[model samples]
Each structure stands twice: as structure tokens, then as C-alpha cells.
Target: MSWTVHVGTILHLLDPTANPRQCLDRLWEEVEKWTSIDGIWLQCLPGHLQPSGTVLVGRCPDNADEIANLASPATASLNTDGLPVVARQLRDGNVPVALILVSHHHQPQPAGFLVDALSRYLLDRLRLQLEASELAEENHYLRSSLTPQVMQHDILTVSGLMETVIRSAIRTAPSNATVLITGETGTGKELLARLVHSHSTRSHKPLVTVNAGALAAPLLESELFGHVKGAYTGADQDRKGLFEVADGGTIFLDEVGELSLEGQVRLLRVLQERTITRVGDHRCIPVDVRVIAATHRDLSREVAQGRFRQDLYFRLNVVSLTVPPLRQRTEDIPLLINHFLQKCNRENYKQVEDVPRKVLEILQAYPWPGNVRELENCVQKVVVLASGNTFHEDLIPPTIRSYINEPHPLEHMSLGSSHSQDSSIPQNPLDNLRQALEHYASNAGPNIGECFHHIERLLITHALNKERGVKLRAAKLLGINRVTLDRKLVEFDLDVKRGIGVIEPLVDASES
Candidate 1:
């Protein structure tokens, strides 16, 4: 078998002498040429320039570098500055810089050493360019990938918040304190319980998991604390209960909120005494086991309602962990999408290159009521239905479409109630504006200001869409003059000259 070697080429341009407009034009040309290369192309900007010009320097892969190098030396010299100029343009334009890795596999040739060295050189140059670039957004992909793997069954993805939870759970797992993993249904509560057990000191011991809500009172009692022969009409043979079986290990009780009062009493006894007696037999058996419980229902509320035991709730919640909903961190959507797509490709024996921008936009905009599990199901459906490299928006489920189109009641201002509501709410438009700005600011990293610019552009685009791409109407709706809107269109980096024939219906039409 021939050994495969992966080659990566990265080109970096440091300082350029050309004007911003010329720089951007040159950068786009170079990026187009390097589209087929097996590496990334990068451009850097000078530190002293104002943050108004396009910040992106030119970028292409190794293959593109080869093509550029093959050109006349005079042309290559211009091409060399091309990458830096693009980086400068992107910085000035305030576009968020996303570092992406594109991989390729090829059989090594006799000159592999030279090629490999060149690749390393290119990567070094790219890193230098990235450092010198005006944007300071940090990369988390590598750090995220290095997170300790949980039990394969426990967590589906190692997202930032999930990683924090897992790491915290690992540290607390060895102790005998009861662990409560809380989240919405299908958010992997049981998985977190098992992960706690697997990482605990009792790794070699058994882990017995029971669904507290699945069994009737009598059966659940026998299943948990075991039953002696002739304990009940059907009990003909002696059997160890979950607590007994989990000796020196862990016993996980899932859906703990569903446990009846009687069941909770028995469980509380076992937890407090560290011993259990089989039904129909008076002899108590001592067992050393850690208890990890999970629940989707709000146990505190259940306790308040007298449905669940308060003592049991307090015991189980010794170490509480809450899994964040997928909607809370929309930034992870791309990573999850790529992960699911790769899995589908492997299983279905199909190669898919691109996920259409519209599909991602819909995904980001939709509120995932069922969280990650629902998102995974949607991905599976898309993969099964996909016939080409691109995933079409039509393949998305109607439920997601409904979410995207759902009207916001707040958007409509009732003239009668507006005054009273405004009085009660005390119209602090400046404070509300500040809060919104801060929320976006905290999440946007170094590209906060740029991201804001993009958001403003998006708002303008929405206005244009509402007016059916009529510039005058859009400008009027936005409360800006046509000339001002035209300048804004350019500032937002929108293509004003292109016909807006393909604009989609505003997902949030009421808001628009």
C-alpha cells in the first residue's frame, strides 16, 4: 500500500503599496486562482492604517500558490502582495476572519521531503499573517478538539459549555455525593450520569441504570432493592437488585422526578443507610455504591407541589449540572452541521461538499425547541434526502419553517395599549439600545464593531427586501435619504448594482 501524505500550502502577504480598492481586486483575483490548491492563502495588513479599507488580504491554497509561482516573476511579485492586500481590505471592511482548514490526501512522491518542507514554510507564513492581521479573534477549534472524550454514550458533541460541565463532573465524580444532571428531554441526561460513573474511581465496577418512571411501584421496589425467593407470586428465584449489583460502583436513577412517594421513601432509605434488604427477607445487605440521578422535570417545583420528595431532591442535587440548550450557542451550529454531514457521508457512501448558505441561515434563525437531539434528527433527515453535494433548503422540515415564519407579537404596536405599556415600561430607549449593543458586543470578540456593521447591513437588506428591492422605498423605510442609503449599501459591502431578483421572503416579515 502506498503511503499517503497530506500537503498544505499557505501564502501570506505582509505589507502592500497598492490602494485599498486595487488591493481588494488583486486579492479576489489571486483567491480565485488558488481555489484548487491544497492549502490556505492569507493576507496581512499594516498596523498603522485606518480601519476603513477592506481588511482581507488575498488567500488561496498550496495549489494556487503553485499556479501563482508558475506565472511571470513580475506577475508573481504583484500576486505576493495580493494576499496581504486582501487581509488589509477585510480588516478595513470589518469582516470577521474565520480560520478554516481544508484537507487533501495524496500519495507521496520521491520529492515528498521537499514538498513537506515547503508546506511547513507556507503554514508558518500563514500563521505569521494571521498574527499580523488587524483582527484579534481567537481560534478555539484545536482546544475544543483536545477536550477529554466522555463515555461515547454520554455526550454527542464536545461544545464549549458541555466541555465545562464534563470537566467539572469529572472532578466531582470520585466523591460519594449524589449528582444531578438536568436538561430538557433528549438532552442526554442519562449520558451525563453514566459519564460521571465512568470517570469515577469505581471504573472497574458495574454501573446499573434504572428508569424510575418505567416500572410500577411494587416492581420498581423489587428491581431497585432486589427480591428474595417467594417475595411475590412470580418471584421464584433469588436475585440481586440494582443497588446490590452496583456495589463498589454506581447506580443511576433516570427520570428521578417520576418516582412515586413510596419509591422515593425506599430510595431515600438506601441512600442514607448505604444498605438494602430484599423483599420477603429481613436480612440487610451492605453495599458501597455511588448514586447518580438525572431528571428533565424541575424537581424543585415537583417538591414544592408535594409530588416529589424534598429530601431526595436535596440529596440528588449535591452536584448539579445543567446542559445548555442548542439555541443558546448558535455559533456551534456550523461545527455540528459539518460533523453530522461527515457522519452521513461515511455511512451513505456519498461525498457532499457544500451546505448551502440559506440552509445555515435558516438553521441559525430557527429556535431549536427540542435542542441538540432535534437538530441531529434534522441533519439525518437532510443527509438521507440529499441527492447532490449541496443541501437544499426545501429538504428542511416544516416545523423549522414554521419557526422561521412565526410572527413576533411584540413587533405590532397597538396604538391604544402603546401609551400605557410605554408608561409602565418607562421607555428607556437608550438603555435598551445599550443592552442590545452589549449582548452583541460580548459575543462578537474582536469583530464586534464589524459584526455590528454586518447586522446594520442585514437590516438594510431586510428593508430592501420589504420594499421589493426598490432603493428609494427601502431608503424611505429606513429613514435615510436615497444617497445615504446608497453609501450605506457600499459601506455594508452589498452589491447594489446586482439585480435583487433572488431575494427570499423575509423570515421575520413582521419585524422587517
Candidate 2:
């Protein structure tokens, strides 16, 4: 007589999505149906990582407990009472990973070899399911590790300051009141302006933008209030300004503090009367426009300094939104890093998908004076310069790396049971001096003169890089006067390259 079982029939018995216990239970029913099997079980062996020791699936339910005890890997090949045991070892290389145990109660069993072969095939099928399950688990772990927050209105942030700014923008968007947005130059004031306009009643109409500081003070008036034919040089035809263009919509005036006193008076009039008069024309053109102004300068201070109009400042400050700088909101840096990583990957035709934790720490410690825009530019440069998928410390500019790369004695200290948080801060001046003295003691000589030289050069170079090579700014950042900074610059032989102040790090030859 010929026994019968097909491959598809066996596959249907084992569900890959189910646990091994469920798979074995379903598989055993098929085995007992097609053969004269009394019992069958899978026994776990060493290195399987399977705490699921044995799965019994066949008949002999009355003596199931006794049979299961014998089915474990230690007693897998033992026959109990009148049953005979036939086993197949599942080997991963030379080591046994599992044992497929089968029991029967007939002499001269022809199906014994066939059952062993079937057990091996079933175990292989289980291996496939295990591999797939592991892959799914790994993907989920990766996604959880990557995202802690989501972007709202294309703005990704978790900081309370930023959330407050966004909430204010949303709450104030529906009104016609002029909004004054203030922040550092790169802190995304214009983005908040667009957010306000997009959620406003005037969203469907044109939204005009002008860089109030980026124009000549003489021409700024014509640019905002427009010019008629023959109003001035190059005024050959009738022209409408940004206010006219943005009528019935919203207009964003960036760097509004740069507006001249004359321009400020006209702006205040337009705010008060809802009308504008063209240059060389007296007729007031009524414009139903909402103005949103932004500035990196302190308008209140500008007003106090008498350079800006107080009335205009008050008119524009009906609603105010101040964006916090990135350094103040360091908690959001990780989310921003991943956001820019994926964005730069698509734009640069690169695949820098990995951002390790050390990179995050280094970036977090930085006082990003330039804010979000600088971070995005840093990430973009890193993506372009990346040689592989992972980001490395060397790819980051020396200006940023210097903050984290500095020598600190407290970094490795055990503190001898001190629990105070102050112990974890960077090495103090005295501690740093002691560390240098000890190091020099262990060296060939006392290079005290050279030690100070290394520090001065490194600091000057770092400051120049951080300030992007502006001499006055770098000197201010370093807490030194211009003459001292210039003298040091000459002494260190630090060349200030044109167009962005690139200064190479001056490494000591002895240290190298």
C-alpha cells in the first residue's frame, strides 16, 4: 500500500503568521491523519533561543503527560512503553538546533524514514516563518527609534516656546490685525508669517513679500507705495507697489526696521487710513490689505533710539509672535536632524539615512547663533560631503566640532561617590591647569610658553570660524578688543580667507 501527502497539503497545515505551538498543533493533525503515528513533537535544543521546549501534536492523549516528558531534547530518542521513537536532528551547521520526535507502535515500520524526512522539511518551513517575524520586529524597532514628534503646518517642534508661537499664529490668523514677528535672522520668522497668511481669510488672494532692508532707502518708498509715470528715474510707466499688488490679500514686510523715517510715516498713515498714495501722485488708492511685518531687530529699541516710528511700531505690534532660537530649544534638535537628513538625501541624490547618537550630542551642545537655517545648511553640507550612509564627526565643520572636541578632565572622572550635577560639568580653570601641569611633568620638558600658544591659536581659530570670519564679531565673541584680536591673528599666522572667513585649525607639531 502507498502512503499519500503533497507539498501544498503540508504548507496549508503550517501557518507562517502563527506561533510555533499553533503551527505544530495544526501540523500534527495532518501527520496523524496520513500515517499510523501515535505521537509527534518538536524538541528544542541548544542555541535555538526557544524557551518553547516541546510541542506535542499527535494521539495518545490519555498518556500525553508521560509522552511529553520523554519528548524533550534530553530524552527525545527514548521509546516509552510499547512505542518506538524515530528522531531527526535539525542542525544549524554542525550544532543541533532542534529535534523532531516521532513515536509509533508497529513492528517493521516502513513509514519511519518518510516521517523523519517530513519532520526536517517542516522545521525548514518554521525557519522561514521565524526569519520573516524577526525582520518585521526589527523594522518596527527602527521606526520607533527614529520619530518622537511629527511636523505640524510643515513645522517640526516639541518645544513649548515654539508651540505657543504656533498656537498664537493659528488663533490670530483669521483677523485683519497686523502681526509683528520678531526673532533672530535665521529663526524662521518668515515661515510663521506664511503660516499666518495661509490660515487667514485672505489666503485665496495674493500674498506679497518684500525684503525691506535689501533695497536702497531712496527706492524703498516707491517699492512699497508704488510710482506713477515720471515719478523718478526709470519710472517710465504706471506702477503698483507691493501694497497694491497685495490688495485684498496679505503682504509680508521683512526687516521693516530698515524703512526710512519718511517711509515709516507713510506706513503709519496706510495703517491708520487703509490707503496709499503713489510717488508723485496725490490720490489715495484704497487698499483692503493685511500687513504682516518681520524683523530680526528689536523694534521697541529702534523706537526708543528714535530711528523707528513709535506710532508705526504700535500699529504693527497689534499681534506679536517671537520665535525662540534653536539653541534655546535644544530638545527639538534630534527631530530636526532627521527631518533635514531625509530632505537633503532627496535633494543631493545621496543616501545619508543614519544619524548616530554622538552626532546628536555634538549638535546639541552647540550654541547655534544662526538658528534653524544654519542647522539645515550644516546638514545639507554634511549630506553632500558624506561618503557613505552613516554620518561621521569629521564631516561636520570644525567650527561645530570644536565645542565638543575640547579637552575636559571631568569627562572620565568617577568622582568617588559624588552625586552632585556640578561634578559633571566641564573641567574648571584650576582643574584644567592642574591637568596641563601633570601632563607637562610627564613630558620631556616644561613647555609652558608653547602650551598657552596652542590654546590662544585654537580659540582664535574657533571663534573666527563660529562668527564666519567677521573680525568685529569674532573679537566680541572671544571677549577681546580688536587690536588684541588683530595682533593674535598676525602672531598665529591665521589667514582670513575672503568671502566667509575660513580659518584653518592651527595644530601644535609637538602634540601631533
Candidate 3:
């Protein structure tokens, strides 16, 4: 966090050579007390100066002739060189560098050539300083902002694929090549485009996005390439298109595969020539723009089917990236669910606690056809409906409920099998019934009839256990009219009172 400032002074007159260093030293002493500054620099004679941990020196020429004459055996060796050497050193330093040109006196204007050279040199240094500072600040900010987002976007759980694409995109962002991002519809292809733009040299400029699918062919072309006045009936005044507006920046073409063949050809020509001809004007206006295209459709298949031009496909696919769908990474579902729940809570101004284990199981079991977008919507719905601290099964969308009831692969077991043998423990009838009910309830089939039957049996068994075999009391405990419980007992062909009093024949004999 230490900030160092390099100050270089060029002495034009040699008459007061001894006093120049003294003046620089005094300036350094004064600047040292400034809290923001960590260090200072004082240039002694050309190519020679003292060095300190907090201060250093270098050779600075006062005029172009002096600069031209000073040279060294090796370029790395600092000598009395021209402004180029100073510029190189300033760039090499980690901290900001400032150039101060000292004349014999504080004249209103030094000689024009001297003033011009000094001004140019100072400007160059200032530009470098600004660029370095901007880059540092941006890096720091992005690290803080994007570190947490990595978890949010990691929902796809395809970190390897995403990392490869991100790294490749970053490497190619500075170049003029067009990038094509292809993926399933909710896989965040547009987000990837923004990421590329953010890391590119053109990040300072606007990233204009155009949804090709939303616009008609003619309008799409005009929107992308601009239209001149009187080009059409509705054309009132000259208009700048996306390409013109996104000059020196990136133009993100979303759903680029939806573009008509003719539009694709025009876009291809623009990419190839780096120029665009307005809808009406015959003149071609050169545009400097980076093209980043995204599409959910399979462009290659579209090209093969003659829907998309092969040439245009090749032009746009200079660097292709594929974002993986969410289902492929089941492990990330819980993480994504949490992120969506938090987002919903913030938007709706509600406090939601933990997602119930049953709800999570339901979410994980269902095959998400709409991908991440569907999952996000599902979470929002649950958050909206949630009342208590814990989200319950009732909050889950009906479409996902069946999956949660689907029987596990290990549900069926024979009585003599290892699983049944370990689970079978001689115990009170109520205890055995409770265990059986728990198992059946947890393994309820996806069929609603089967699930309902399991739930009703569990409720009856629990009530009977609580009433200790008293049929009338058990019926009352279940909150059912006595006649209804009596009908259920007869329907199940079970004498609730007798069954509860009876013990296992083997256990009774052993006790005797």
C-alpha cells in the first residue's frame, strides 16, 4: 500500500550546478512529510546520482541536444538519455513518476523548444501514471466484487469449463477477432460476453447489446448499421446504429443465430472490413468495434441446414465458448438455491430461514428442463409463499413434488436379506409400527394414491399407539368422528383394540 513518487528535474544551466542538487534535496525533505507520499527522487549530474531506500536519482537531459549526446554501453544502464529513457524508467517503476523541469529562473515562458519538449515529456509521464493508477484501482475493485460472485455463478458446477472459456476469452479480448458464445438457454452466455468485454482493452467503452431475435430483418439491419434521413417512410432524421454507437467498444449480438441470411451477410462484411454502410447512404463509415455474439441455437447445425450462412458462422466463431447447463452439475443445485433464496428475500423484503431437507431433496430429484432460470423462478416462488422459519414441502412447486416421492433404488428388501435382518428388532408393537410407518412414509412412491395411502396408514397407527389400544379414544385422538375411524378400522380389516393388546406369540411363550 505504500505509494512512491519519482520526481525528475532537468537543469538547463550549468552555471549554478552545485545549487541544483541542493534545491532538489531541500524539495525532497519538504515532500517527505506529506502523508500521501512515501518517497522522492532527485536527479544529480547527468547519469550520476545518490540513492536511498526512500529516495533515488537518475540522469535527465535538459535539452534535446544534450539528450541525443548522452548514451550508454547498455540500454538498461541509466545514463543521460532523452525523454524516451525517462519514459521507459517511469513505466518500469511500480509507483507513479512525476517529471519536473528546472530552468535558471522562473520565467513566464522558457524557450519555445525547451517548453515544448518538457511539456511533451511531462504529458507522457502523466499519461502513464494515470493508466497505471486506473488499472490498479480496477483490479482491486474487481477482486473484491467478483470473489463472492464466483460462488453465485458456480451454480453450473462446471468450473473447469467456465475457467477454460474465461481464460481463453481474456487472452483474446485485446484482439479484433469476433467471439461467439453458445449454450443452453439459461446458461448465461450473455454474462460471459459481458465478462469478456470487462476484461478487454475496450472495457472503457460501451458494450451495446442487440437482441437479433426481437427485431424484424429490415429493422435489425438498420438498427445494427444505422439509417440515413429519407431512407424509409418513417425515417425522419439520420440515426446512428449499434455499430456506430459502440465505436471503440464491444457490440454484443445476442441471439445472433436468429439474424436473417442477408443480415448475417451484412454483419459478416462489417466484421471483415471493419466498416459499415448506412441503410441509405452509399458511403461506408469505418467503425472500430469488437463483436461478441451469443446464441442458444446450434449455429453449426443452422449453417448446415442453410438457415445460417457458413461464412458468417466462421466469421463469428473466431473464438467459440460453450456454457454448460445446470443439470449436468447436480452438486451445485443447493448452492444455487441458496443464492436465489437470498435474492428473493432481498427483493420481496422477507426473512426466510433454512430450506427444509425435503424441499432440497425435491429440488435435487427433479430434472430441470428450463435450467438455471427455472430453478431461480422456483426458489422465488417458494420464498414468496414461505411463512415460518423453515421452508416446507408444501412450498415446492407441484411439478417437482412427484420426484421427491419417487422410491429410492434400495427401497425393496426381502425379510431374510441383510438390510431387513439388521432392521428387524423384537420390540413393543407400537415401536415396530412407528419404525415401519417412518420407512414407508419416507419411501412413498411418486404415485399420489400410494403416497396418500402410506400417509393415512401412518396417521392411524400413530393415533392407535397414542390411545393404547382403546378404539374409541384412538378415534378421538385422530380428530376423526368415531364412526369414521370405525369404518376405516373395518376397511383395513384390523381390530385396533385387539391388535394393540396382543403381543408376538414367540415373545409370550419365551416370557412364560
Candidate 4:
């Protein structure tokens, strides 16, 4: 039999008759060098030596000549001084006739028939190993290729609102325009910012990020525009600010609404002049960085309240992207849940194979206030706590589990309400409404019909406010036709446009 030995290749059979005990010890030591595994198992006949079990053997780069000499068909007991060899007997229905050698990630052993055929043993093992290696490489390639697809799957939604947001983000990604992403907290503002940076021309450069809300005004200033040595109390060394670090790339300013008035001014200067001055130094350094700001706060409202500057708001609002809250895109819940489940399995090493239908329904119904971030946490929790392969309601966190199968008042009026037809709004809203009516009645002294009108006016106003002053949507929430809504608007002296109503005392105009 001919056996070839070379560097970088695995599999080497030692002399047929080697000192079994010593050979086993050497083989184990050698295998340990290649991978971390439990002690080796030696299976062989009791009499004259027979090799068996599994052994790992990789050629050494430094000593190929020595290896060839050791492996030469010499009538020697497994040469302890040269290459390592192992001996063992295969279990019932399985025998190691051909010396099986493997590296760290070993391939499956060939069938017993294939192993016994001396002529084809080497070729078969080599072919199997090559195929296994190729399969492993292909698997790695597929995983890497699927990464971006998974990300897109997680974000892309069936809802038109989310599709519009994604389309807008794509349209703005390639441009050099400053982008301001607004949404509720945990709505993936930073994630969208990263998407913009990844698709932009500046993708090749760094995308430095800083949370404006995380740092104080002074520290934040230093972080934005690097300070020179000795600029402040502990300014030991000159530091390059985020803008400088992101000179040819994009700088993501997260929670930008949290910036102090002074911080806002400095940021404004960077936007307007394309330059930033170090804290201590008066030198204005030109920067070619693109600014991508994100916040959960309404900057327009902030500007109105004198908290945010109008000019800065306009500068950063060059291309505004509003990431829809998860509740608004409930249709994507199943996709996201599955995506997160796969992610949890990989990260937590838990094989939660499936999510139960009831669990999925509950997850979709619950309003994720923390948005995608909250949903991710929920999935992770369930995966970690799941006792079996399937995720169940019992595995969910208490807060989410409690809400499962429970109806909420807000679900009744919102356009993006849950789809469970059997779910009815809790009577809490009605109870609260009744309490308000009694309080108002004691003060106004109105009769039954007039009181009913006042209550209808209050409900309509509430719906209109919730619908952001959209008359048609408000009418839908009130279960009334648009004509009826318009008449109610006039009767209550409600200005739908202003989202407020002026009601003159409910006079019995019929008595008049």
C-alpha cells in the first residue's frame, strides 16, 4: 500500500504493528496540538497490534523528510520517535480497516464496506475529505452572503407606510445631503443611519457615531470638534473629534434633540460652514463629513418651543426619514420574529426551532413601545427561557405574557390596530368617559339630550386629536359617516382643522 505524506494535508497511517500503548499516547498528544477534544479512544484486538477508533493527523511544515522516513514501510512497531500513530478496534457493525485521520473539523467516516476495500480506501477517504471541506467552505460563503439579505428581510415590510420609508431612505442614501431621521425611541434611527452610510459614497470611510444625550454639554462639544491639548481641565492630549474622525465619511449624531443650546450652535456652525473649530484653538478646520442626525423628539415642536434652533432644524432636515414604529408595521411581525429567533439561536446557542401560533399572535398584537429594539429583547428572552424547541406564551416575559390575549382600549381606535376580531376594547375607556361626564354635568346642569350631545362632542374631539386632526380618520374611529362627522363638528362648534371645539352652553334651541 502506498501512503503519501506532505505539509498542510491531514491523514497519516503509522507502521502496521506499533506499541499500542505508547502509540496511543503519542497520537493523543498530536491530536491535542490540532484541536481541543476529550481524551482519545483506542479500539484494537488484544493480541498483535490492530489500529482502530478516530485519530487526528496533520503534516508538519518543518519536517517533511523526517515524516517520509518515519512513514516508510519499515518493519517497526508504531515508531514513537517519528510521526504519531493510534491503534483501536471499531465498534460493532463499524471497523477502522483503513487508518482514519481527521483534523479539527473532521468529516464523517466512510461506510464499513468502503473502509475494508484496501485498494479504494485511500482514494475514498481523500475524496470524502475533499468533499466535506468544500461543503464547509460553501456553507461559510452562504452564511456570509445571507447576512445582508437577512438584514433587508428584517427591515423590509409589507405595509405601504414602511415601504415608503424604506424607499425614501434608499433615495437619500447615495446623496451627500444631510439627513435627519425622526421616530419614537427604539425605532432604529441609528440602524437607518448606518444604512444610509453603508450605501453612501462615504461608505469606504469611517462612520463615527456619538449620542448627544449621553454626554454633557462641555464633554459633547469636545466630542464633536476635537479639543487641543490643555483645552479644558483634563484635556491631557489633543483629540480628533468625531467630525475629524469622520472627515471623509458620515458622522451619526444620535439623540440630537438632547443637544444643549450651545451644542446646537456649534453643530449648526459645522452644517452651515462645513468647518469646525477645536474647543481651545480658534483655527477653523475644513471638514467634508456628512451629518446624519437622529432623534425621537419632534424638532419642529422643539423649535417652536425655543428648545431647538429653527435654522439648524432646516439644515439637518435636508432629507428627513421617519422610521415607522413597529406597531404601525404589524404585518412584518412574523418575519421579524423569525429573524430574531434565528439570531437568538445563533447567539444563545439555543435551538428554539419554532414559535407557537398563539405566541406569534400575542407578539403581533402587543404594541411594542420600544419598537424593534423591544421586539428583539422579547425574542431573546423567550429563546433563553424556552424549555423545549418551540416557543410558547409561558416562555414570554411577564409583561408581554400578561398582555397576550388581552384587549386594550387604544387598539379599538388606531388605524394600525390588532387583527383579532374576537378582541373587544376593555370597558376602562367607557368608565373613564362616564366619570368625566358626571363631573362636567354637576358643573354645567344639562338635561339628558344635551348631556348626550356634550358626550358625543367630547368623544369626537378625542378621536380627532388622536387622529392628528384628520377628519376622515376621526370619523372612522367614531364609527360615523364623514357627513355625520361634519354635522357633529358644526353642532359642537368644533374646528376639526384646529383640533379644538368651542361649545356654547347646550341651549334647548327646541324650547326657543
Top candidate when judged by lDDT against the true structure: 2
Best by TM-score: 4
Tens digit per residue, CA lDDT, model 1, 279-341: 889999999989888888888899888999888888788999886666544545666676777
Candidate 2 lDDT at 196 equals 97
Question: What lDDT score goes with residue 134 in model 1?
Answer: 17
Better of 2 and 4 by lDDT: 2
Angstrom error at residue 219, model 3: 0.7
Q: Model 3 over residues 326-397: C-alpha lDDT tens digits?
A: 544444566676667678999988776466444554565465778789999888888888885456678888
Q: Arrange candidates, best TM-score first.
A: 4, 2, 1, 3
Model 1, which residues run further than 4 Å from truth? 1-159, 344-353, 411-512
Measured with C-alpha atoms, the lDDT of residue 438 in candidate 4 is: 84
> For model 4, where is the 10-residue window of minimal lDDT?
419-428
In model 3, which residue pairs have backbone atoms overlapping below 3 Å?
none
How does each model score on TM-score? 0.52, 0.53, 0.49, 0.54
Count of clashes in candidate 1: 24
Give the residue spans of candidate 4 off by over 4 A: 1-156, 409-512
Q: Compute the lDDT for candidate 4.
A: 0.63
- Candidate 1 yields a Cα-based lDDT of 0.59
**On residues 1-512, what C-alpha lDDT tens digit does candidate 2 reach at each position?**
12223211122233347764454454444443332332233222222222222222323322222222223333334333344444433333433333344433213234444455544544454554554455445435445645443466667877655877899999999999999999998998888999999999999999899998787768876888899999888899999988999999999999998888877877788899999889989899999999999999999899888999888999999998888777656657777777788899999899886666556667766768889999999999999999987677789988888755453332333221211222221212222435544544455367677666655565566555444355544565666666898998887777874212434544453666
